[model samples]
Target chain A: MIAVLAVVQGDIGIAGLAASGILVAVAIAISLWRQLGLERSLLWASLRALVQLLFVGWVLQFVVDPDDPLIFSVIWLTAMIGFAAYTTSRRAPDVPRVLSLSIVAYAASAVVVLGVLFGFGIYDLEGRTLVPLAGMVVGNSLAATVLVSRQLLIAANEQRDLIEARLALGLTAKQAFQPHLRQALRTALVPQIESTKAVGIVFLPGAMVGLILAGVAPADAVKVQVSVMYLVLGSVATTTAVMSLGISRELFTPSQQLRRPTQRP
Target chain B: MSSLDAFELRGVDAGPAGSPILKAIDLTVPANGVTVLAGPSGAGKSTLLRLLNRLDDPLAGEIRWRDRPLIEWEPTDLRRQVAMVFQRAPIFPGSVIENLRVALPGVSDERAGHVLEHVGLDVDLLDHDAETLSGGEAQRMCVARALLTEPAVLLADEPTAALDRTARATVEDLGRSLADSGVAVIWVSHDTDQLRRLADHVIVLADGAVRATGHLDELDASDDQLVRRSVGAP
Candidate 1:
């Protein structure tokens, strides 16, 4: 199938890569015409992605084979999860020890979801299966974590008076936070749900389209895409739910009283 | 109704340890009459009310209710027994009746209407939206909500400050009625006129400690500057 796609689409050699410059020039042109002042950021982001992907491809030369040792797969995926967590927690400043917390979230979600896949014999626990699967889980979980944690802090701060008022009315800490937790979960999950809802109709998803272009049958491609979508959704929901519960618990002291360390002035 | 007869705070220091807002506060809130806590700004009057409900624990010392330490009492149980009405009325997003029913489950519409009447609000306002209420109306709504809990003691922090003179008079009468009905009314007020008119017992606080405690007339004769300044005695 790879050979067929390479024959049909032609090799994406160095010259072909140079041809992609036209897209960048178009972006630069729009940036100039609109005076958006985003030319620098756009240029930097494009260059960074180029360097990062090329380096990843070079590194994959040594590790892409499923025959590679499982130890290498575990170590590599752990590093990827660490980086994903760091990036996600950066967006949620109010979350205490956010980096460590995100690590726990991403690792746990990836483990359970990947374990289920392994149990089903979909892929062995090696780099070929582990890297891509972990990528899907970690990347998608980052988005959900950022949304959930940000909304959690925002709700806690914006609704402190209401929450404390509930607490004042003889409700426990968890009961007082029920509304805020509900709001956070709703906000975090809606985007993923919407994308899944519109998956093929609004736009052909990247994974399915790629697989079809690579000469997999259209039905086969669709099945693989559906599986990926379900797996990613499950991973994200688990990450968000776990983190939300933990963060809500953090909002209270050991004595079950609210601790407003993140109260906005 | 419960065996708890009063709130006892013995050397009950609160706030942050280094600079406590309420320091060594030894007093008892007996389950009767109006015990008015009076002070100038920053005297920790609101903190005292919060302590009664275990909103925050003291930095040191103990607050007991019914001879049991407040920390030992379940917070929910304690709060139900010691209901609080904030200064701004804590008007939330809901209908008036929903606000009333949030704290007290299964509060019948008739009972709700009765409490609103006691707070000088018409039962017709039951369907009125909480956000649309006037300041006085919101305060009254909160009071009616607190009353539904059938609190053994009501701790109000400037509950009538938002009310107009007529509304304030009505709430004052309501407080008197609550006291008469055997609810211990612990009203925190800076308004000397209100204190003089309403307080059966006055606690004058200054620098986060009680400067004086006695009858209103007796506090008016106190020589301490905290008492003299707060009571406004010439």
Candidate 2:
């Protein structure tokens, strides 16, 4: 199977490589436009994507050829987790207390999902499955955690008075943020749920297309795609729930008054 | 005790030592009437009103509520017992119902509606968003929210200063009604004519010092002596 893929890749050659580069550049441009509209960061993000991809291509040659795959997989997973933590924390620093919690939630949930799918029972920890599967879980959870943290923190700040008023009325901290918690969870999950609804008809997701191009039968490819989709849903849901709980509890003292930050704005 | 007296200010001095805002102030407010603290700009009337609610702790005096030192009460408990209506209504961002619910979460929708009606607000306005309300409507809503707490004392800082004549008259009527219901009202106003119309007891201040304290009717009558003595003397 590897020999056939290598021969086909070689025949396509420079044209295939050039096309992929163009596609990646276009993808980065679109991501920049959608995530940060008309900001100076868009140009920085484009340049960063180009450099990061080149660096990854350089590193992957050594990493993929390893006899002992565990070390490579562990390093890759750590890098992904660090990126996820940085992205989530940058979106919401008001809840700095939950920075480590969000990262841990992402890592633990990703490990469990990827472990179950490619664990000892299914197969030995093969790099092919571990790499792609872990990538999906980590990437999706990163996006979801960012959404949950940013939305919930903004909600808490905007309604600080209302939340404090409720606390004064004998409500526990959890009860004070119950409404915002629900809203944040919904915001985190809605995009994933909507994409799931539109998966096969509106768009052919990457996993299914990649499987077909790798010469798997269409029926078998569909099965793998469904399982991967379900895994992603579970990982994101867990990350958002855990992160909301961790972040919401950081705003108040046990005495219920706002721990007004000492630094003046 | 009973309905005769609400709050007692003893030696309440809320400013610097050389020039205190409320210089050695002493006043006992009866439990159920309007006490207008009137003076020109920079007078300590607003400062004295804030001291009544302990919003500004006096630098050098004691405020006693029902014979107990105000410092003895929990701040939140005291806030619930004594609410302040800011001069310019500070409408929180959200729906009108949510804004009203902040002061007293225990109030039922029915009770909120009743309080709104008492404050001369339209029933339909409750569903409107808070940020869209006019200044006068927002002030009325603020008063309604304060009423939801059923506070014993309501300190209104220029409650109708920003309102037109019609809205001002409407708010003054509501203030009179609140006072009639036996809530001790300390109304701060820059308008002396409005005080003459609404105040049962009048206290005039000059640059953070109480100049005179007497009944409004006596001050308006030939007893211009009190006003003349304290009007310009700091």
Candidate 3:
């Protein structure tokens, strides 16, 4: 516990930590002054984020050590994937096999994205690069997976007659569901694509800002930011594609008949 | 097992498990002529029709299509043979020809025109956007799409319930003509006048059970008051 606190204190000195607290205080004060009814939530969320981030920082100090084996990185990545899957399953309890589907989606994106980064030697093969890169991939992919799972299920429910009409005309389940799946995928992916398009022009991304603040050259920071943006976009596309296809299969029976979704209460 | 029967159901229980809509139904659908399934709302007429094409399976008992169990046939093959037209007339996002091609992917423009004309639609509408079609035109287009598969049995589930009187007459005539050409037409109609006009055989359903199964004359003479009333018999 002391070691973790020491590490946190070294990274952000006590005065810097207090300065961050002041920022939260300002947010809470504004919430109260405006009667937004969000002061309590704002305070709680800020405190929780502080604690969680500090804990993660402390853990990463050891995990990213030069002496540590790559197995520790693998374990950390696996744990992140598992937690992401669990979170997605909780968010979409009605979707069948959502836990397994999420696991596959997150893991597939991480592997594919990380493989390109390291396989092509864009980044060093170490805990430092592996953990944060995979974290970004898993984090960005989570929302896309949840969006696609829910959207596909919604399409199945709202477009029941259309799907059944196609099925009645001797179309296979895949054929009947192709259009809806494409729609869901588009719905899930468009925001990511749009953000990717507007990344530098609209506003600087976090990674680029962090690099620039850390005194990296503007051109170097831009390069890293562009790579990160592409990876995030790729991860979103991969995760949504896997999730939408998996949910599409679950929406039908082996007989190619549309299985009516259990109505949400 | 008769060759004349298109579908034979024995002790079929359908719908949700605990609260089935069609309960213990034993019936036969003829392979020729128009058979109108007449009932009040919630009588499971549509449910029974769905069972014939394997859209929804029965909870218990068996359904045979042409002496073969429904489960034995490949769903795609079975559906191609037993095409259905829905009430709302779902139109895909394309021209009328593209919609027709959903059933027969390579359907030629000439063949598309012929089928459209057969359903009382102008062939000139073939190139128009399907979503631009009027409700009646869309419904007839759906029928034309079903016919593209060259199905042996045409299941019309309240196909004209949404159309105007003129449009209803047109669709009803199309069904009649299809049946006259030897394709078994199983139609569901809440309108007693339509039952009187198109029924060569009538299956009167009430609360999921078969109240009467015979010609319109037989239904008119039914001892069950609900059955007689279903056919609008005084």
Candidate 4:
């Protein structure tokens, strides 16, 4: 099985990949039979993912140098943050200036968590180690930012009258939104918290499996995986706090009246 | 009389539409009295009540609280002195004591007992889940929470709308007692009987403008059919 997959990974590469197109065909056929109306999206998503991942793989061969870590990371991460900001904007398309807000929030959180880890020599500063670990942490935080921003906006909008009632009763905006902010952060953190709980017992996470597959010692892989889990969790919590607090500020005017974006316009 | 005014709205423009919920109309609420805001639906009574605490700022005029612009005061600070209860009261989750403590931390079990008494609720009810309270009980809890702050002015937006008649009377008596204690109570009620029982001064609003402002008899004597239509005719 190892020898067969090795040949498939090497000499039969393009042809081997082309044969997997059959899977997309089968999925589209199933969607058609079910009248799911998802055939177009399913096809586009599979093809787009294939092209994007292949392109990134080709680019990483040159950029993943152990000797030069800082330049590509700074450049690559700026681009990743741009895309993450756009992804977050989809969650709250009506929120004014959501792109800039998301960029600032996500980038600040990623930098702080990844920075401290590498800066303390807890993780090596090599390109291969820093880039991959930073990618995982930042990627996890992006999901948290989207969920936290969406939940905060919806919850705050729904509770405007009640929040205003508190504001009218002498609670500052900070105090008024404390409950809502906690609720939003909890919702965003649930995925990470559950994954952290389930990682070892229910399933081995991808990073641990990948490290083990690369011939690292199993004990060593376990330690790296634990570090990765904590990094991702810390990244998510920090990102959520920054974004939720910033977004909460925007939901009120200078006079402290709640401002809800009721429509896209 | 002007010196005693709790709030004075001058040429205020506010509301949901270009037409505004309240147009360029002026009104004053006398301090230490039950000023009933009487109007038909959509006539901006609630909008007026909200503006008193700067829940929203007026579009193009001034709202003065005790001779200073309402905006001059920090909104949270102003709201502390000018607290409000809603048409449907907000009962936060947790025990009733928790909800009170959210507003006034270190509020003693003793203080809770005392404040609940002001709203006519027994002290033992404080331990119940606030979310489990009956509609009237929840509303009174809101009132009790507001009174705990010792507000000089209380805004009640149809506080008894969801209550049974006995609950309505309990709330009305509470408002009366609040006014007697010199909290300048600005209340909005659509119920004509509630108005008669509670209003010390009546301000009639129609089409986002003040149609009449006077004692109930003076309101009855005024020729504005809009006032009689809002307050209900003899």
For DockQ, the strongest prediction is 3
Residue by residue across A156-232, what tens digits does model 2's lDDT show?
Answer: 66766556544433345676568778988999999999999999999998877876776766687687788878988
Go through the candidates in order and give each one's C-alpha lDDT: 0.82, 0.72, 0.89, 0.82
lDDT for each residue of candidate 4 in A41-97, tens digit (9 for 90 to 100): 999999899989989888776557766657886777777778888988987776656
State each model's C-alpha RMSD to the native.
3.2, 7.5, 3.9, 4.0
Q: Candidate 4: list runs displaced more than 4 Å.
A: A1-47, A67-69, A262-265
DockQ for the candidate 2 complex? 0.10
What digit string (tens of lDDT, one per residue) describes model 1 on residues A126-245? 676678788899888888899989888877777777777888888889988888898898888899999999988899998788877667777877777887898899898989988888
| Number of the predicted model whose TM-score against the real structure is largest | 3
lDDT of 1 at B128: 89
TM-score of chain A considered alone, across all candidate predictions: 0.89, 0.78, 0.93, 0.83
Each candidate's DockQ score against the native complex?
A: 0.64, 0.10, 0.84, 0.74
**C-alpha positional error of residue B174 in candidate 4 after TM-score superposition, expressed in Å:** 0.8
For B1-234, candidate 2 gives per-residue lDDT tens digits of 274346787887875446666777777755568888777778787777766655446778788887788778665677667777877776766888887877666667787888889888988888899899887888889888877767887888898999998888888998899888877788988776688678877788776666667775555553455474433222
To one decimal, what is the Cα RMSD in angstroms of model 2 from the true structure?
7.5
Interface RMSD of 1: 1.3
* Tens-place lDDT digits, model 1, residues B97-199: 8888788768888999999998889999988899998877787788788878778889888889878997788778888888888888999998888888888
The CA lDDT at A7 in model 3 is 22
Question: Can you give the lDDT of residue B23 in candidate 1?
Answer: 85
